[model samples]
Target: MIQAFYLPNVAQIKKRYENNVQTLLKYPFLFRKDFPDFDSLSVQYFPFDDNGYIPFYKNENRFGSYINVNDPVIDRYFFKNLDKPILASDVYSQYQLEYLNDNVRKSEWVGQENHIYLHYTNWCNFCNFLSCLNFKQLLPDKKIVFLFEEEISRYPIDFKKEFGIDYSQYQVKPIGIREVNRLIWHTQLAAHNGGDFFNEIFYDHPNLLVFKSVMFKNIKEIVKNLRRQWKQRGKLSSRLETELARLRHPTDKDFLVALFLNNACACCDNFRFKNSKLQPYSEQYSERKKRKKRSTQKRNDGISR
Candidate 1:
């Protein structure tokens, strides 16, 4: 049984780290009441640190160890002295198993084999651009499914109105982190802009198709080429290949840090190289300024006429 402990002041905690609860919500199966082992497993709510770490406790015997979810130093110390620290990514996989077991009998839309799961959360501009590349004309034979981070109604514009493609015609579903974990199991191929969620879920998946922007006119062709190269060489020729390699054999906590730095820009910056080495952000800033100046000059000249 696994027990997670958090501060009792829920509103205050949620306001501080908005995504914290969202992350924890993925483990609902641990608290299920109907399971035969439910009595053995339980979660307790307590008035603990309101501004500090969320704690986790596991009790197999009379004694249990305390783990601070937010403390990296503690996590490292534990790993070095005791056992490999249970990472958020580790829990992510566990959540998937629990979800699959619970829903195995149900007729929910679990992905199919060789299916392409596009992680379009609608939160990142780059992800949105990648999703747009999955035009119907590109992959007529493949089964393409889109996983959204939020409900369709929350989106400001419909895909039909904005991109001229009716998303309803395709399999588009809003999913939480747990559902995403379950979906990844059935997905043989995936296309994403290197979001953290995707990075964690598909870290071990061998056939991942990562793209930065809409550089090619045909998304399907590009994915096919990448998959071919990946199968032959065990890696892609893209800039993200190095980062992707590190993800495959993630050894320590640095993997998550690397993913964060690598995925810093959802669409714009090629973080694969930038995050690995020292570079000047000012250079990119200056280039943007120059482009803005040129655009402004053209606009001013047009207005003067």
Candidate 2:
């Protein structure tokens, strides 16, 4: 059925989202985040989807993290192609999808296991809220991060190609805002206290960070991006790293990123992947937490009287 499903083409994407949203509404408990309006698709809009906090699940299964889908979004926008609509809004989703596709090469649009494709405006909120799923429920310690910025529109494709493949991972970018550097500094500070996920701010101001903070959050360029992450992790103000170093692994998931990120700037506090390798975060749990989880497992192990 998955393969038989026609990947939502330019003409079909709107219907898919509308149907999907309708389907989601039947089960409010499942997706607590706001369903993305067909209008919000093109570019990031502040506070709309800051990171996915609406809800529409039947029983209870919030949509997990967001990965930037590939580049057709950009193509559609250029052609003025749009996904269908629920009530005829601005078609933001179509525009955003096109914006992201235009931002990255064709190869990177496919999904990767762990990564959150953030958009600068409302889309960022959408992705941010998606983080709550305990997506690591199946794969423990999965690493992911919010990819954003509003300046990618400056360099465009030729500029990104020079940066290489990893650059493709960054989709969902913003167009431009002259005050980005200062804005990001504040954003990072606000998100820092929420939890471990937001603890690590990629102070990475890539040439592209100029895009929306959701899509183009990479370092200056590929080469510099890597260097900055490694060499500069410690150089950020001590206040930034101080609280981060103290994060206790989930006293209870109540404080988890999935639960509370949307309350503020949106967050991805506990990432599972690092440097292209997946890290098993489950291992970092305390003995008590492990025992608690094991006890729940035992209960689920199925031996009811």
Candidate 3:
């Protein structure tokens, strides 16, 4: 059996200890042989410097091979020096029965269908605002629960006052990466900016909606689209909504096992799993010359006319 150590980004470990701990517990099965007494393994925390890099663990350690769940650039450094450099997805094919069993208990958090999960970070505040506003207009009855990376105060605007929305209508809470996983597992619907994190974890979720920050060209266009969607479909059905609500809640052991197997077997984009070096683009000056010639000919013809 091949044994590998799981190395998450030290910054993430420091910021979200609880969530990282859960991931450490659940995701170790990605390896063939478990680290000796894996449950009893103690983690040591280190402080990160200005660039979010830990200077201490730059060299190879006693841990034979390793699987990393961090940015590709950061992983690349380890890959260059490490004995065996396997990406996180490389080991995702393995599943442990204990982890699947544990997921069933975790799924208990899945509850009523009335709550809508909204994921936003400081980077994409405008998209978050638009998503919340649109959802409120479309489904006034549904409660909006905003999940953030840090404290709600870090956001630039007060969502209620800025949008003229009531505070009673929504709730804001800061969540860790692991909590986001559990919330996605149980929530009725998740509206987010289509970040890589959401794409990876909630890959199979049915009721996930993504709004692009760059798509906000004009208010009129946004309103027109929102109204069009609302007119076409009045609202989600009670039964269908309830069904989506229940899908996240895995009560039965068989369902949990099946889901775990599906996740393990599912294919992800190969590019996401590896850090491909940037390649230089060949010049297309010939195509540009042809286009310029055509433009000149058209202008001359217009003048002659």
Candidate 4:
């Protein structure tokens, strides 16, 4: 069971540092949840202050992956594979903070938006919402990614012409949503190694934490799906439940969900590791993939016939 400390409290501070940021000089990301014994696994999250506290993302690189700032996030368990901290002076485009500073200005310029807020509760929502919007709204200044989802592409040209909100303003660009999510996972893992891994990867793009609810729902759904698969395979449902008790103390909600959702565990989404409960998910995924291929082949055969 993954119990995440979404904010930097005295407890979490105790886990990560022997001294404060002033002494350690480690710029704190949103909240270092994973800090496993002298810098190991820390929870997933976006670095808001580089050293302050802003918790509650609501899932992705599981300080539990969360929103920019609202509620606590889901638990992320990644490790550092680096020799230094992620926020060294060398990497940023030009220690100028031009891009990020611009967004803060835009927030001030555009002011507090009456923007319709859409956030994720699970990883599948991240997948589903991104599928619907095509990732145009992942940017820091986006005002209407969720709004774009409502528009269907019947005749996009005509539709754009009909709407006064210039097609250019609402362009739905393509992006590798899956790839980005993986980066979220890796960066969170790197925090334990002192955050230097970030310098290794994000020289051009500074990692902006993504909407958390999406990742949460995505993982929750995956576990649930896995459990369902196991039941279908005619395995004893109680077997996974037994495993859950062994892995996680009942006090933990994350583990409880693991136990409950274990019955339906399918595949790990953004986070790679899977609890024992959903081990059967792989077998089910393979079987389903084969069935899909076979069905497609039959359709081709019919066209030939």
Candidate 5:
């Protein structure tokens, strides 16, 4: 059975996201209808953060943003720990089970719902994808459907090539947030890579299985490592604040550190830090275009010769 867990403490979270949270809280009251109970579980790359801070947040560009890591040593540290493959059993452990059990007991989902929805963003990594496989294994009898952001349709990863998962098995629809809410009622279990919609969904639906991926245990130490590095850097730049502002909500002294590490390790973007600032993707794209043009010109010259 999928399990529900405690929602993150957003008491001090920013107003930008808090508005959605408030709206979600009023959902059941407004509808005043009997919502079916399903075993709901939310999953992400890392285990869910119990302390209330979500690792992923929206950027000004509305893309998966990464924290700038000026130190090569620290950058390499995150890549080694986060970019590796993870096993299902390693994550679905006693600790997670306990949280799920406790939450499920308090939830309204009385455990009869059978539909499972797997939601992820365009920037999800192999580990996030691995969780979907784990869920299918855990609940084979349920009707499972994968719902991804429309942008995922353009993602270049080959599921079959990398993990032996047939594209046909995905059964995904490129959808938006509205579509997700429309289908949420039918979803007995909901798992998503921590997305912005989490603000509206996490506590709004009780008794359903919903989980937000936080960070993994193996990489927690990076939080300390990055804190020291950033502390030494003195003041944070405006660009970095795009992420740091949201992370500051958690009371942990360097709570933002763990979140920074989370964004730095995202699988989708090849993020780089320059002069202690995060590089924009537009620049990266322009560079790629120039390189392609240069390569094409070289090939034509060689042919003429």
Candidate 6:
């Protein structure tokens, strides 16, 4: 879960902030979820004086990675409360505001009659949606749709072309048919970290049959598929679930590697790691040549003797 506190409150912020100028300072991208100890991280706003909070500058490292604000009120708040306070200004990028305004608030589409929105806030989620799309999950009477975040253009993938949207057109908008009650949108908010959509978009949906493509959710599906395949092949281990549960602080990569290994094992009757012979063919060949040369030299020396 992500906890964010903005002075003037996010709802009260002006429209310009909603526009999310690339150079402008926005809310921080909290990795607090990444750290269990800092699960309830908050970005409270406190100013040094009544002149309103001084505008902060960009970190230049990456969009919304971190911010450096010099305010006495904020400093004091951090000093007394948490050792390292992540101020609202510190973790903001244009993406944060974009998510808030374009996706969450401008969601008038959510209120439409007989509609189910299949929203993909980033490229990874979009790809996941495409791969795991099951028409049976959607209501036949209701329209099915897709949503994409505009920043998806940054990825090399031709998403617009995929859905028959104009390739040149770029913006956060819905793009899907409405034969009954379905819609699609490109609400590009969370970029590299697609998981953040679970926190940002999932909680507040009202009367809206909203579904965001989540990587972990897809992983669960992949696990089930692999489990069935392995079980069918008589390779399902009783201890497999236990082994997965034993992983401490496992990442998406870890789960993926496990899935891949299980699938490979099921596909191949003789799947085993030969670490000793895992080297590249070129390297192994060179080693063999070196050994042959050494043997030849020893034989030549013996002949001379």
TM-score winner, 1 or 3: 1
**Candidate 5 residue lDDT tens string, 254-273:** 34433433343232132322
Candidate 1 residues 176-276, lDDT tens each?
A: 11222222223324465445565454332322313232233464554555434543553333334454454554332333233222333333332222111
Ranked by lDDT, the better of candidates 2 and 3 is: 2
How do the predictions measure up, each by TM-score?
0.21, 0.17, 0.20, 0.21, 0.21, 0.16
Writing each residue's lDDT as its tens digit, candidate 4 over 81-150 gives 1111111111112112222222221211221221212222332223321111212222344322121222
Residue range 157-200, candidate 3, lDDT tens digits: 33345545444332222111122223122322336545656555
For residues 216-236, could you state the per-residue lDDT of candidate 6 as single tens digits?
Answer: 446677765654554343344
Please give the range of 10 consecutive residues that has the lowest summed lDDT in model 4.
Answer: 83-92
Q: What lDDT would candidate 4 get against the real structure? A: 0.30
Using lDDT as the yardstick, the better of models 2 and 6 is 6
Q: Clash pairs of candidate 5?
A: 9-52, 37-109, 40-209, 41-209, 41-210, 42-210, 42-211, 108-207, 109-207
Candidate 3 lDDT (Cα, 0 to 1)? 0.29
Residue 140 local lDDT, model 3: 25
On lDDT, the stronger of 4 and 5 is 5
What tens-digit string does per-residue lDDT give for candidate 2 at 2-108?
Answer: 23332223234345455545543453222233555665543221221433322323234333333333213433323222111011112234334333333332223
TM-score of 1: 0.21
Sequence-dependent TM-score of model 5: 0.21
| Pairwise lDDT winner, candidates 3 and 6 | 6
Candidate 3 structure, TM-score to reference? 0.20
List the candidate 3 regions with Cα displacement exceeding 4 Å: 1-33, 36-45, 49-51, 55-225, 232-305
